[model samples]
Target: MTLASSSKPSANRKPTSYESLMAGVAAGAIEGAITYPTEFVKTRAQFSADAGGKRGVMSILTDTIKTRGISGLYSGSGAMIAGNGLKAGVRFLTYDSIKELLRDSNGKMTPGRTVLAGLAAGVVEATIAVTPSETIKTKLIQDASSLQPQYTNMVNGTIGICRTEGVMGIYRGLWPTIMKQGANSAVRFTSYAWIQGLMINFTQPPSGKLSSTMTFGAGAMAGLITVYTTMPLDNIKTRMQSTGASLKYRNSLDCLTKIIREEGVQRLWGGTTPRLARLMMSGGIVFAVYERLIGVMTSL
Candidate 1:
């Protein structure tokens, strides 16, 4: 049970690409399922054009349940449950691959260099997986005007977008998604690395093992920072992807402008609480499971 460190690549065994990918996928699936209700709330809040101001998380939750039924709390979760594995797998696999190349003579990446790697990984994942998944999820959640629904499920939602808007439609928020993912990963990885380094130095366990609590704490803090810093971009991405032809934002910038003009600047921070809560838990679970699984699988 050794604490994996930047300076100790050999001392701390690493997982293979396949192993890391699988570990990430497994971890993401678990986290996504667990935190999906909060995510549903977050998306709904983001899409709410005239929230007046920051609404309470519970109020949003209760309203959603009352209007859309309890099932509404899980609207578009199919995409989340389906794509989160690929999203997280790509994120970890790409991050590790890039970080491996960036490690210095001591097999260590400085916090700054680690942030670069995280940024790269986030960009790659967003381009390959996140944009499409989010597009479908948002469409299903926010585009449905009536009880009939625009998308009955993920598959049809994806098909409908493709049929109507072509391939480009499914990637409507690609730029914002990349920016958000890059910034999110940069902050998350940098903070986690700094905190984990401190934890390793302070504990210095006899067996060189850092406990799960340490990993979870580091990840939670990192997630909180990411959520706070990237909420505006997240809001923009959601609005752009979900609005479709109705609002017809030209791009992320346009989306931001329209939201501010029509809804006020405060609209950009909608759903902060649920998003923070979900990501905090998700970050802890994702990193802890990823690290633990890496240790277990590599040993085997």
Candidate 2:
């Protein structure tokens, strides 16, 4: 059921901050766990220096399974699952808060306000949860691909990175993370709203809420838009967060320059396929689950 499907006006009531946070946490965890294999492949592709030829998603998946076993596809899933939940909670909380603040006297948020709220939420999540979690996740994936893995698990990897590289090691890709996340949420939220609005206008469901199918379709479209627009930033973020990033590239810009100069412009989209698949499903899963949870919570 969509948010607007309730017969009573109270059923359509906006979610409270706590509701948003909890719903987001559940939604994020579900999405992360379900789509993690694609995420693992995407990170590997992004960090790989295969200038001679780009590997397809299937190739990477088969290779990882062949060498490291099927479980290898989930190498850093622990960090991703935990981090996805936390960051999603923060994201929804911040976005809802800012959206409330930006609402007009009529309690409507314009597209610009929505974008701003999403951007703010993305930045907040990136700083608080995404950077560290992603850094560890990237390192773990990279480690798992090595001949002899250094870190055994998420906890051990976190401690190992800190012990050797200090606390900042876990925040290796701070700048690019912020940029990527900010743009990601902004584009996603804006596009989702726009597409959902169009769908609602066309369907005009009796309860005023879109069907689950429509909501998922709208979200998937938003994810598709987000993937192409933000792929380069994502590549840069992965590169900066990977092990030995400090030695390989000076900063985000330098990383961009080197990838283009050495690997060609198309290399910027190294992991587009896996990332696109994950995010397309991610958008649908996250919003659908969040909306369902919010519906349940608000009703109670």
Candidate 3:
């Protein structure tokens, strides 16, 4: 899910860091729960290239449901829900803080500064939260796909990975995760801001708050842009975090090269369809919820 747009502070009061963090947590948790099935499908699709399967999104999704039941779609959801909440909270707190620092005398930050703030927030969240959780989630999902699943739940999965591969196992794809997250946030924030600016120019809400509908639309559009732009990095990150990734590929660069050489360049975007579906809805849900929650919290 994409971050909530960093709207201008309310005329009466700005939200405190706690308010932003709480709002982000709620928004992201809601988004993760709602869109996780699509994520399951997407991850499985990414693995199809290595398996030499020509399955499409619907095919994979249907197979998962038929073979593994509905719960299979939520195999790694615990890790994702937790990670999404924490990362989104950290992201909003860091982005808002950095954006505040970059604001000039007019209380406005240039687009470049906005991008820089988003990049910094992304790197921070990836380093602090995303990589380890995502690695665990990926492993769980991958294991669940097998005929005999190894890990039963998030806690067990973490313990199992650590027992087998050590602590670094859950941080396997650190560099690729950072790259994907950094670019993802930079593009998402910039595009969301630009879209909101255009909408504001057209509608000019008296309170400087776009309607919920407008905000959702803008966020979904931003999600669309981000998915296409960052899909390759996302694929690499997923591969790197998967089981046996270290033995198969040396690093993120090697993963990229091998995927291109063996699976074809288009394989880099292997999970684009399901990811696009999830993020489009995720961006809209997250931004709408976060903005509404922040508005309520700040007014309190």
Winner by TM-score: 3
Winner on TM-score between 2 and 3 is 3
Candidate 2 TM-score versus the reference: 0.95
**Model 1 C-alpha lDDT per residue in residues 129-204, reported as the tens digit of each score:** 8888888888887755345777777888888888988989888888999998888888887878777777777887
Q: List the residue pairs that clash in candidate 1.
A: none
Better of 1 and 3 by lDDT: 3
lDDT string for model 2 (41-112, tens) is 998877665435566778889999999898999998999999999999999889888877887887666888
Stretch of 10 with least lDDT, candidate 3: 1-10
The CA lDDT at 136 in model 1 is: 83
Q: Write one digit per residue (lDDT tens) for candidate 3, span 1-300.
A: 122233444564677899889998899899999999999889988887777885799998888889889998999999999999988888888888898898788777688988999899899999998999899999999999898899999999999999999998899999999999999888888888888877876786777788889889988998999999999999999999999898999999999999999989999989999999998998888888888888787677
Q: What is the TM-score of each candidate against the true structure?
A: 0.91, 0.95, 0.96
The per-residue C-alpha lDDT of model 1 at residue 176 equals 92
Clash list (residue pairs), candidate 3: none
The candidate with the higher TM-score, 1 or 3, is: 3
Question: Model 3: runs farther than 4 Å from truth?
Answer: 1-9
